[model samples]
Target chain A: MEQNIIVSVDVVLFTLSEGQLKIVLLRRERDPYAGQLALPGGYIHADKDRDSLASAERVLLNKTGLVSPYLEQLYTFSGGVRDPRGWSLSVAYYALVHESLLVPDAELRFELWPVAAVPDLPFDHNRIVDHAAKRLRDKSTYTSLPCHLLPELFTLTELQQTYEHILGVALDKSVFRRKLPELDFLEAVPDAIRQGKHRPAQLYRLRPDRRLTIFDKTV
Target chain B: MEQNIIVSVDVVLFTLSEGQLKIVLLRRERDPYAGQLALPGGYIHADKDRDSLASAERVLLNKTGLVSPYLEQLYTFSGGVRDPRGWSLSVAYYALVHESLLVPDAELRFELWPVAAVPDLPFDHNRIVDHAAKRLRDKSTYTSLPCHLLPELFTLTELQQTYEHILGVALDKSVFRRKLPELDFLEAVPDAIRQGKHRPAQLYRLRPDRRLTIFDKTV
Candidate 1:
């Protein structure tokens, strides 16, 4: 009866593509629900891994040939007969990476699906994705979390669009621009400008030092 | 090698007493640093429990003889050889209760210690307590979490005191009063006034419907 809880780590990796927030999902290779869609995850290697975060990173590196710039512990789903093997617990995680960061790998195939159109996933992955998406949007309101969803160099217009995409709402252009300076992480690139249909907009990149910054308070 | 990961739930129950935030702790009875101080917790009974939250509620009830008004999933601490009994994971939870509600249990002695003065605890319980305290303070800034630390019936001044105690800072009375109306949860109890040293101050209580209200934005 003791030590009966099996532990695993699942990563809900999110990225933006074609102006839509998408989740990277992989097909499960083994049984319980073979060939079904599921988050990239694997059993926690107690002997080799340092912690759940490390286990999650290892799983992502092994399964998707990509490394996320930002990964946070989302939640731990346990109990209930979710796993056919036995009663199991999964330390779930959510990671954010620019879609362009994904490197093609011949051994693994990953597909990006719009979060709104996600199909019924294996186990409770659909629930995990939904929870993670909510967290991302919630944190985006105050923190620099949305910056991770965009490339290193981007125009202010592109940054605003990324936020709008994740939030699923069109924000007021002036209000968003006014709040930009308060974020204090965007450093204007002197000569960089993106020629949009209307005019050239100044480009900015997240200051290297602010890559891991969480704003002290909501603006 | 399967089903080797041990899973448990730990509860960090906090309450206000003597105008200070205190945590409820229990002394261990067996081999795990026997007789040492630790957070109230127990192994998840897979056969009887529904999930980690249910397990936490059960443990709190059986050990402390009281139910928490607010219980949240704080964080999950896993991996590391913290547990001498092999690889184990504990889903840590933090709860809030009013001191008046605790009915002393002779068999199960529970003591409330100031959060800042907590002594070294057994296992990773010390780290769990610290993390939960930080989360409480962080959430207090945006949510109506300060309400949990106060009794069901309290004055506006008492409510402000509770917030000040948790935040460890002084607030402007007029500014606080101006923001009170926007909370939308405080209802004045007519004819119920506390005759203080100077004058009678009106009494108030959390509106029954908004007891669980979490403000949409920070004050």
Candidate 2:
């Protein structure tokens, strides 16, 4: 009876690097398709906590030696035939890490690939990444999830550029600025940050307490 | 190594009934929490298809005796000890079905519960449902996914009510009407649908050629 159940967790670590959305993938060291690039993941422990999110967190930390960042469930892959050996169930999670915060250790061996240029991943991971990418693009238009990937304080132009990169389209600057007041969840700082060669733009931070509900907003 | 792989699939089926959002659930028939209410799911087959989505589609049809409808990958649940028996992974999918399409067969036994008053579900399915509900609410704001739950030709009032029921809020009539045209995905039909108490309202349908894209007009 114990042999019938197999649980695993896969993590899709996302970050913005060099103006592109990148995902962290590992080259498997063990057999059963060793050296294939795939998401960092492993089997669940019977003695661990029952909560799926906590289990995903534990597996991620063990594999990459990284603590929690911005993690959320992506989707579950339960195919009668996903595993060659037997029936294995996998719960996939997507995480966003600020590019500045990523510190890869020597012991951890993985490569970060741009989402647009990633080759085929092993065991249906490509599909998982595709779904998460689409969700990220869709959610950014209506929710505050995208802010989690950015620095605490950012210029409106920087934020808009992030949106453009993910959505793969140029937006109207005038209309975009006109819609900012309706967000209500962004608060401008009294001081502005300056960059080279252009005028300093106002910096804004996410107002968690404001809790903007865009349930009816035009997406 | 043989003991490490375990996989499963869970499905969240959504339908509109009597102008309310409802979910399909099943009463457990076996041990490890017999008689408990849970999502209809089971172990993945090892030799069927390697794709997670295909696996989900196969399991969904087997358990519910239903064919394809509007389905999307929702989220994955992988906790180390979610299953008391052993390690198990679960991939979840969300499906939207029109009430008229559901064929209640004797082979499939389950109950439809209103989203507002769902009872305790087995494992982490309760949390899964909550996440799916939130996604449905948020997706309705920008995409045409919610239209899958409505008839081919529906009134604007019906569309608004569908949004209201899923969002759990009363939207302003004028504001919602104004936003519909901005979407550019809905086309008004020449015919009208009559409600019992109100004047005949114009009906509308989603444009087949206009695919949903996550792009800002200004960027």
Maximum-lDDT candidate: 1
> What lDDT is reached at residue B13 by model 2?
89
Computed on C-alpha atoms, the DockQ of candidate 2 is 0.37
**Tens digit per residue, CA lDDT, model 1, B30-139:** 87689988899989987788777778889999999877777788778877677988777888888888888776768869898999799999888888887888888898
- Candidate 2 displacement at residue A188 in angstroms: 5.0
Model 2 fnat? 0.60
Work out the TM-score per prediction: 0.94, 0.75
Q: What C-alpha lDDT does candidate 2 achieve relative to the native structure? A: 0.74
In order, what DockQ does each candidate have?
0.51, 0.37
Model 2 TM-score is 0.75
lDDT, model 1: 0.83
Residue B49, candidate 2: how far off, in angstroms? 6.4
Each model's lDDT comes to 0.83, 0.74
